[model samples]
Target: MTIRKATFDETQRILDYALVVLKESTMGFVKPRVEIANLIMAPILADGGYYLIYEKNRTIHGWIGVGTIYDSYSEEVVGTIPEVYVFPAYRGQGVAEKLFHEAFRHLKTENVNKVQLNVFAGNHAKKLYEKIGFHDVSTLMEKDLD
Candidate 1:
């Protein structure tokens, strides 16, 4: 398997995997897949973010998207990973870790001082993050009014 930056032509494939992730993680939300995909891919395509894909034998098995965050108070740039998804068949084979390491390496070259990511509560990937030197710095809480 290899990890590399995604190209424009691979947008559709990335969107397909992103939709699968959204469906698995959210509830009671409805949106046209193409619309959602466009929204997600726009920034990455515009160079405001980074998107990476894991491919094996010419088949894409997973992807990750990360956007840059500028901290006004600290005058520093941070990397925020918004999504990471590996197909079921590719899980447990270190695909996510490889993708993350490659992304982090690229971000470091861009002078990113820190990297952050959000994992759904109880998601097994949380353990992977922890194992890779990520520590809890804050807690995010939300309430559903409807």
Candidate 2:
């Protein structure tokens, strides 16, 4: 398998994968998957961000979206990994790990000091992220109103 930056022409395909990830990972806290996917992808496609695809024999198996963002609390620029997904059949084969590391290497080139990503509670990928050296820095608590 090989990993590479996705082209602008490929944004919609990547967004399709992103929608699946959001649906599975959001735990219903977010709504309207299509709009959310577009919002997350627009900045990356416009500039200052990247979308990477993992493929084997020219067939895509997974993708990741990353970029740099200013963190007001930290008062420094931080690398943001906003989306990561590997097809169900491709899971457990290290695709996600490779995607993350590749994203990290790219971010380092941009001179970012640290990287951060959000994970919803009960998402199994949280364990994998921890294994990859990500630690909890803060929690986002929410309340549902009727």
Candidate 3:
């Protein structure tokens, strides 16, 4: 599979991919997932924070979206992985790892030397990440914004 930075022309496809991730990989989110993806997926596609789409022999598979992966408290971007997914039918095929390596190579050029992400404590991907060289640091604590 080949990975490329998504162009704005791929906007609709990106939103579709993100929505799939939210719908299939997560549970109990009250917000309208497609609505959220529609609202937020555009501008970032216009900008560049390692937002990537993966293809196999030129057929679209899936995509990943990331902001500034960084020092959680320092506010300096180390690496970022806002979202990552392979279509349900496409999972278990190492698509995410390829997408990640593509973005990781790009981030290295941007001087982002470390990568960070937040995963719910029980998320299965945490095991995947540990296998890929990421380790648990601390848990994320949150409060509702009003």
Candidate 4:
């Protein structure tokens, strides 16, 4: 598999893959499937954000999105790995590993000291992150009231 920057024409294809993964994992309907496209594209199209897509045999296999976060008070440039997903069929193929290292290279050029992303407490992907050199630096909690 090869990792490369996704062109506009490829954005729509990635969006479909993202939505299918999320819907399968969440077990709920996407409010508006189209929003997944926005979620996948918004940052990459933004001023200092990017999307790196992984492809094999001309077919998209996975993607990762990143952006720079400016802490207004400190004006620091912190990189964030906002999203990453691989089709279930593509898992364990090392697409993420390839994509992540490339994104790291991108962050380094931007002077990012650290890159961050949140994985649910028990997510298997957390292991992937750790294996890739990310540590548990913080915890995220939430309460659902219905």
- How many collisions per candidate? 0, 0, 4, 0
Top lDDT prediction, candidate number: 2
Better of 3 and 4 by TM-score: 4
> Residue 67 in candidate 2 has what lDDT?
88
Clashing pairs in 4: none
Pairs of residues at least 3 apart in sequence or in different chains that clash in candidate 2: none
Q: What does the lDDT come to for candidate 2?
A: 0.85
lDDT of 4 by residue, 1-146 (tens): 67888887776666656655555534453443757746644764576576799888988888888787765545786888767888778989898888899999988987888887756554677788989999977565677798
The models' CA-based lDDT, in order, is: 0.76, 0.85, 0.69, 0.74
TM-score of each: 0.80, 0.92, 0.77, 0.78
Off by over 4 Å in 4: 24-44, 71-75, 144-146
Q: What digit string (tens of lDDT, one per residue) describes model 1 on residues 40-118?
A: 5566556678579999999988888867876565678788777788888988988888888888998888888798876
**Cα lDDT for residue 34, model 3?**
62
In candidate 2, position 69 carries an lDDT of 78
lDDT of 3 by residue, 1-146 (tens): 67887776664566656665665444534354667765554544445654688988777777777555336587786776767877777889888888877877887888787887667645687777787788877866678899
Model 2 stretches with alpha carbons more than 4 Å out: none
What lDDT does model 3 reach? 0.69
